[model samples]
Target: MSTQSQPSQSVLTEEESWELLAGQKIGRLATSVAGEPEIFPVSFEVSGERIFLRTKPGTKLAEVTISPRVAFEADEIGDDAAWSVVVKGRAQVLEREEDLAEARGTGLVSYLEDGKTVWIRITPSDVSGRRLVPGDQR
Candidate 1:
């Protein structure tokens, strides 16, 4: 028997998207400031379908404060397959001490040493993902 294969992409379900988010440690957060778009690499943690990240007072925080709407993306590539997920939502700054304390318990840390004390929570309202697989696996 002979089989023909073709490269294909599949859209991940909402549950699958959340699963990917749960396992991902780092993602690019895209925000806009002064009509210019910017993307920042952020280490994050997932809790109850929401993402938490730590940031210091800087351009990222400033932009987020100006406009809470943002897009976040993460991806994983394998030998012959890959998948990517994107989240679109609003970023809310955790100002309350209790909220910050709770976010701190999620094990989310920053690689920068500037002391990123600000915690931002991204609540995804539209989460989507796609997976690419070699046709041979089909």
Candidate 2:
């Protein structure tokens, strides 16, 4: 299915959905490794047109450090309902300390777990979201 959300009464407006997604501090980032989609839950924030994530030295850091293209997602769910937003983008490490600080500041506390804090940023080429409600099941 297309990533973009189909318009409906149960669905939130694109702007509303994006705003919700962007405000959240965590999501699943999907990337390809050896032809398989690798997805991981991560803490992140929307900074301008880019989404910034912080990771320690690990697969997440290693994967994007090698390949820049990546996908990001953030969603919120409730009883019998949910909304999700997807972002197709290019990923990179935030090199500057100022940018890193600003990106980290976006969330309550730090976005990273206790460890060596490494910054990863994704510049989105496409943004999409969808919402599911009770009537959609019919």
Candidate 3:
């Protein structure tokens, strides 16, 4: 019996990559607080060009609000398949109470151990993604 090697895709198209991010539910939000880089896995919902991550009031919250600039990323890896996307831009905490309540209702749990009652918005300046399939090699 002969078996064919699974085909691999090394690079994902911009549309394909964005679609993956949009359809996904969970991702990691990376930021710096107290001069230390921090990464927190978060449940997200994407709308248009903006990515929304909900987290409760915490140190990260204060960091994002104060810093406003950050990086957010997401990735999926398989035995032979790996993909990652990164977002570089400014992040801002929701100011309106109504928006906060609505975002919290979506059920996004953060590393802080509780869902975000206030949503953090990341307006990506640059967004890119790559995929490593079985065949194309790295």
Query: Highest TM-score, which number?
Result: 1
Q: What is the C-alpha lDDT profile of model 2 across 25-122, one tens digit per residue? A: 77899988777778988877676667777788888888887777898888877776778888898998888888778777766345555785777878
TM-score of each: 0.90, 0.78, 0.75
Model 1: pairs clashing at backbone N, Cα or C within 3 Å: none
Give the deviation of candidate 2 from the true structure as CA RMSD.
6.0
Most accurate candidate by lDDT: 1
Cα-lDDT of candidate 1? 0.90
* Cα error of candidate 1 at position 126, Å: 0.5
Sorted on TM-score, best first, the list reads 1, 2, 3
Tens digits of lDDT, candidate 1, 24-80: 888999999778999999999888888899998899999999999999999999988
Error of model 1, residue 36, in angstroms: 0.9
For candidate 3, lDDT tens digit of each residue in 26-95?
A: 7887888668888877778776667888777787787788778788888887887788888889987887
Off by over 4 Å in 3: 1-9, 97-115, 136-138
Locate the minimum summed-lDDT window of 10 residues in model 1: 108-117
Better of 1 and 3 by TM-score: 1
